[model samples]
Target chain A: MRKIKQWTAMGLATVMAMSLSACGSGKTAETTTAAPAETTKAAAAETTTAGATTSTEPVELKFSWWGGDTRHAATEEAIKAFQAKYPNITVTPEYGAWTGWEEKQSLNILGGNAADVMQINWNWIESYSQGGKSFANLEDYSDVLDLKQFTPESLDLCKVDNKLMAVPISLTGRLFYWNKTAFDEVGVALPTDLDSLYKAGEAFKAKDPDMYPLALGEYDRMILMVYYLESKYGKNWVEDGAVSYTEEEVKDGMDFITGLEEKHVIPTLATISGDMADSLDKNAKWIDGKYAGIFEWDSSASKFKKALEGSVNKPGQEFVVGEFVKMGDNNGGFTKISMAYAVAGNSKHPKEAAMLINFLLNDEEGVKIGSTERGIPCSAAGLKILQDNKLGDPLTIEANTKVMNYSKFTLDSKFEHNDLKANPDGVYYKVFGKLSSKELDSAAAAKELIKGVTDTLEN
Target chain B: MKSKGMRKFLAENAGFFFVLPWLIGFILFKVYPFASSLYYSFTNYDLFNGVTKTGMMNYNKIFTDSDITRAFMVTFKYAIFDVPLKLTFALFIAYILNFKLKGVNFFRTAYYIPSILGGSIAIAILWRAVFNTDGLINAVVTAFGGEKINWMASANGALFVIIMLRVWQFGSAMVIFLAALKGVSEDLYEAASIDGAGKWTQFFKITVPLITPVIFYNLITQLCQAFQEFNGPFLVTKGGPNGATTLISILIYNNAFLRHKMGMASAQAWILFLIVMTFTAVAFVSQKKWVYYSDEDGR
Candidate 1:
């Protein structure tokens, strides 16, 4: 009986603690979820919506984006300038790093609690705008959004089911970068072609066993495989919302990856994962030059270069742009609208939100503040302003030019589906992990990969 | 007369009004979600497209799914190894610390600190750092003229690292055992010693029997916790080097959030709930065989 009493007390305490934590998180979600859902169908957004009514009304618009310090600062400044013009409209800036931001935003959208004007990835348009008007039609607010300033192709990329869902920010694609200092120290020339790249792995390792020719994650390797397939087979990885690779083709790609591992061309995923950094930019191995190269986004190339600055810790670190590794005859490389600004369907002030997006992407004052913060802005007026001011980052410009000239295949959004990531139960992660761990050979892992991708497509 | 009785009853039962806030929260926050998940398990629920009635599709698919089966096997393997070892270590530490020793309080706090920090993402990162290829473990090993080992890269090594993280957090179970040891009556042990019992004999006859209930409690709770373990695998190994550490909870979460298969995820959760409940129920039923109750039968 005494034992039963103590058990009861302890169990009750545990339950209370569990309930308390749940309650705390639930209360926070509730407050946040309720704040963004007060608008109704504004079917006819006329001239009066943009220029006339509610100018004097007190409006609090939440605008959110994910970026580094420069982008955040520039966006904050643009909001202040917008606030100066429209005194009654208070635009609150919500920004964060990119890690897990997409998932958080998806949850926010599900709860009808997304910001009024938010920065969204290109693929989110397909995911969220499928069933209903999940995003405000920018066409309705074209009086402010200025569709004429953007090219039809740029505008078309953001449209879903003929609704102007989002606006293209800039074009982005992967390109190669080499750590010149590391290569020089190892006394091995940087690998310019695929065959040479594979051979460089052994050369670098012989000089310093800690050094790897490249460090790419599962997703990075996947992208490389796509590039390889397009180069060799003249086919994109995905076509018509499905993986277009044959079992043999996928096996070839898998073998190629495992070969790279066998040849020590790239560090294994397990080794790179040890850093626990969100991206290669912050990875200590990459920073310290133990890892010598990356196949990464041109827009994000600045951060990698910045991380490689010849400074106090790793002085005399020289960064150099490398040509894309010639995997096949085609050497596939492509760019897409990296990110876009979209207005929430639940937003109370759709026209005003459009105004804010327009200001940031078009207006001279907005351009001055947010210039080149979001890569080279895809908007014609925005680009002209940045070019006139000579404000584009040189590395970004050079890298984009190189990739666009060489890259042949176009991008497909379905490639970046969450299932393809290196997470638990993720198809690519599981199959690749198996291949690397030698639990399954490349052919078996390839069969698993095909099945996984097929399942993802079917679902 | 009935109205008078009702008013009298109301006055007597008025304390329920005071508890109304908690009761309301429990029903809304806890009970509602719990029931809704049951309903969701039968439907096709996607975050953007909303729910569609899908009958037993999700439940049927669960059996055929290879990942689900693998996850279940991995989780069982983890629980089977973790619980008994953790319990033994906790009880042993409790026994040692039960002795009168100098600076024992400091030792207790230091041992308990890892338990406090062990469940978080930061701790998971630290675990990864400790086990990574060029991590502190390899550094130490190499310093001693040993070859470096791939601690987080190999399937077995990753699983072992995650399990060690779980085992290292034995302080909670240890503290409970310590409390139970303290509660055992001094006279019971004294009587055993006076009756020509040796130290080991006295401990087995008096101490172990009295603390059997505490052991049962720790066993049940730790077993459930081990089965549902997530953070260590999710953050450290990410259930990898080939899904060797993919716990069922990680599978369930990834299925829902990453794959956007809410209905299937709900089905998986219900399956997990039933399994954990069955384990706990078995433990409770078996307790009568070995667990000794101090106040039972006029003892």
Candidate 2:
């Protein structure tokens, strides 16, 4: 009797363990059973978009993006308008600030539970969909999406292995933006070139010890290094998915950053870290016009302008777009797709997701509502609507104009890989950070930088 | 007869049925992840890509990589500084609060509040605010004719700030110590006084021995917690001005989520787990010499 009782207990425990281990297969079975229903929904969406009688069947989609409050509000309103047009379809909006959004979205994609439509960074195509599988091929849904509204160059930026992974929303580039009030307070003319920028840094230091001509964060320092090297060498930062600069060339770029620090052209890493603000726009010194200029994205011009305008020390500060200085004979900046829309490959309603993308980019109502909140629209129709209605932020348009007209370099996707650009452990962060702290000299920093990037590439 | 046998079995196993939900949760959430991570530690699982078996590669990298070495050193330094300082601070405060005083309950609650809110994001942000260059600490320093210190910029300063965060959250340990202190009999102090011992002597010779068991408990718990510390470093210094405070937990997180190297992260986690377990085992082995329980045959 005792032996039978012990055997029964052991058997029950085994049953529990087996059931728990079978959980993954059970989930797969449930998903397999649900596929037919999703297939029917896709068929219904296709027939509706094929100009047949529109289906009254209810369809729900999840669309997610990350942005500021203004962009979130605009996108949410556009989603509402989309729902109004497609009354049978319910679009759930998942939006938040940019911080941690990438990680969350990446996990969602990996878990096979990504949103139907998502606002994705350009590098995500290379990161999450490198093999052209994570995201739905946009070309397949071109019937509903109207890919021609976007330029071929913009479209090319989103393609991997002949598959359109995402549709580019807008192109953006880094440019200098100066606080005119801060420059005027320092009694110095705005810097137009590298020499004058150095002189202005001296002038600012002489007049106000706390003020500096410009401030570039660690990642910004990396970008500027690339720009400097690209301008001098006239080569892409990364060529054929490898570090293009030699050890000596990388040393020169690192030296340039160190020289800027020595001349007080930009604050040291210590100063920026001490500010305790995660981004320049939120830094108190930036708002108060102590850090007179920033090397920032044209898409983010309005945010800094607004932040300075709300400054308590110098309210209504004049924040103007400044020209990109020539680091070498060539122009120093590269234009990048600021953001894009992509549909998950596993989304149940690809056609409907394409329709939502189309409505946001090509539909007159959606375009008007969105305006240039996410930078100037890449879509020809969308840009025309914004231009005709005069609905764009003037500062963003000016900065965008400068960025588009000046930048000639190509930015490789590897430059922004997570391992290379991550906050602390990233190559850019560690190498530049060590340099700023004087723990690694320019020569050693250069070697480390190249080695880190090479290691990432090889892996 | 069969019904009676079924009833007997059900009655005998009632306690097991009562704990079934927790058991299921433990197996599903804890055991599964623990086993899955172990399996992935020996593979090349980049989270997004499918897993590929690569025996010992991730472990080999952990042992050889300079970055991991730095991370382990930083984590060990953090544990060394944090555990002892926190335990001492907690014991000191608990000793003070053990005295009869006015509105002692309010003081206890106020002191305990930090530990309650210590692990939260808000507290981490508050720490940043307090230690930043222009923060309140600097304001106070400057008012006293001192210069501002870059607390979050320098590697040492950043590590100090993180240690301070851990030390400031000594409330839980203090509460545990307070309970242990209260349980110490007044008769021991009286007997010590009759033997011409001072108050300090009484505390050292009498009270401390009785509370060694609790001290051992707090030490083990805190040592483990310190090894796994993440929020303070992650939110405050973000593991650096130059990777100075990049603890193992932060490294694991960076590898797993940011770098997408789940296998590497798993390997790092396993190594950290082993370090903690070894420390705990050593502490248990060493406690036989120092820790005295009243129920033991010491007298």
Candidate 3:
């Protein structure tokens, strides 16, 4: 009887843990932002009761996205506006911060219970869609959605074998930004060229040993490597569904990054990581002027600039876009979809889902309400609408426009594999981490990286 | 007469109906998933498209992938260190708590607090904060004229933090050990003390022998739990600083959800199950030689 009791207890514990893990994977997102489920359910319940008497066939659709307060408010306002225009079609808004969003989405997809109208990353359509049925083809709802508002080029990008898997929201890529005040304090001019950046790093490090000229994590280093190889050699990282660069070629890029490390041009892996912030925009160290420069997405430039609030440095004018370090004459900076919004294939209200998506992307009221929340609307009409209203953050618009004018390459869908880039021992982080941290030589890391990249791409 | 009496008793009190909810849950959640996961191991089951049987393909892929081998090695290293160290710590604390001292209940509760908080993602996040560069540990270190340690960024340091998290949650095991220790008759310890045995010797000869069954229970639990540790590494380092702390459970999770390779994850889960079962079986077999109960021989 005692043994049975022990077994039962153990069994109970295991079952309880299984349930906890189901909820635990989303813990990061939940802690970072309010969970979307409760709000979505509440909105749905309210809509159902409100429409019960008069509605012939009331449709309630779930629309989910990842965002901060600004985006959430804008998205909710859009939904409210959308409901006012079409009272029979009630839309429940689900939104949260980006952390753990992918894990939560994957679980929902697996259970066939994802939101009817979903905002997704472009890469997910490629990874999740097999047998050509992962997400609904919006072409089927052509009547409800105004497909002509999107450029043919933009529409063509989301096609996974002639199926419009997702709608591309906007194009975004990486660039450099500097805390101009930090450089002034250190008595060093902002570096315009690669060589000068090296010198500036040394001067700044000498002036204040606590501060790094550029704070770069492993993932940042990898993006730099990609940009370097692409600019100098005009070669795609992956071409013909395989790795483009040889091990030696990749070695050159790793060696260049480590050379920066040797010159104190960038922080050591340990130093930047010391802050333990997920993003430079949120890092206290960056806000405190310990990090003078950032390598960031054009769409995300405003956040980095804004994070200097409550700091010793002047928040308003201290943030400035930096010159692109001259790698070669070629412009290797690239743009890809910042994120995509899609309709679930299993959605019961496909027409309503498409209608909601259409309203957000193409409708005039949706355009005004959603203004610049999801990185400047992708549609020409929508961008014009936002531009006319002056709804965008000026720095974000300037930096994004700058990168757009400079970029000469576009990333393949395979390049967006999170496993290949961000995970522990991932191609991007493992080799770069080793090189920067002095764990492995450039040659050794390069060889390992080739293997990692090749394996991820092929798989 | 025995058969008639059994029928009468069943007719009089059919209280098994009370357990119907539990029985339904056992079948629906536990047994169904366990059995289906085994079936999934043999198929190419990517949850979105469909499940197609490709017998031995997932197993074959597992053998070919170096990541699986590395994941296994990392998990083994964690289990080997974490299980023994945590159990020993728990036992040590349990021994002290078993003493007839003032505020013993308070001490037990205090020690058991960590376990209550252990299974939370918050604790994992706390562990990350406490070990990061500017974290509490580093703050303490710098206060003592030492440089900040790269606790989360270094390969070894990341592994150390993860192991420490497991050991810190030893309260559950400690509680079990404490109960078993209390159950050990004081007469035996008293008699051993009178025989010129020191405290340590008395502990080993009397206390340890009597608690072997409990130790056996704990060993199984700790070993299994340590191998399947997910939250600590997942929330903290993400098995980082170059996969130095990528527990097998983490690998299974990445394969299943992140990569959408459910077949591979299922195969990995089965392998884990087999490994744990083998360990449990070995412990059970070995227990006969050492574990003693007062009524064992009588039974």
Q: What's the DockQ for every one of the candidates?
A: 0.34, 0.42, 0.26
Give a tens-digit lDDT track for model 2, residues A85-184.
Answer: 7666777778788878888889888888888999999999989984888899999887778788888888988988999999999999999999998999
TM-scores for chain B, listed for all candidates: 0.91, 0.95, 0.89
Q: How close is candidate 1 to the true structure, as a TM-score?
A: 0.89
Best-to-worst order by TM-score is 2, 1, 3
Ranking by DockQ: 2, 1, 3
**Which stretches of model 3 miss by more than 4 angstroms?**
A1-56, A270-275, A310-317, A437-440, B1-28, B49-57, B60-64
lDDT of 2 by residue, B1-299 (tens): 99779768766885585456559879879999999999999999988776867799998888898878889999999999999999999999999999999999999999999999976679867887898888899999999999999986667888999999989999999999999999999998988899999988988999888999999999999999999999888887788878889999998988888778899999999999999999999999999999998888963
DockQ of 2: 0.42
lDDT digits (tens) for residues A345-382 of candidate 1: 99999878998887888777788788666777788888
Candidate with maximal lDDT? 2
Residues A142-184, model 3: lDDT tens digits = 7667677788888888888899988877778898899888888
Clashing pairs in model 2?
none
lDDT, residue B150, candidate 1: 77
Flag regions of model 2 displaced more than 4 Å: A1-54
lDDT of each prediction vs. the true structure?
0.79, 0.86, 0.78
iRMS values for every prediction: 8.2, 5.4, 8.0
Off by over 4 Å in 1: A1-54, A273-279, A310-313, B1-6, B15-20, B192-201
Q: Where does candidate 1 clash, by residue pair?
A: A333-A407
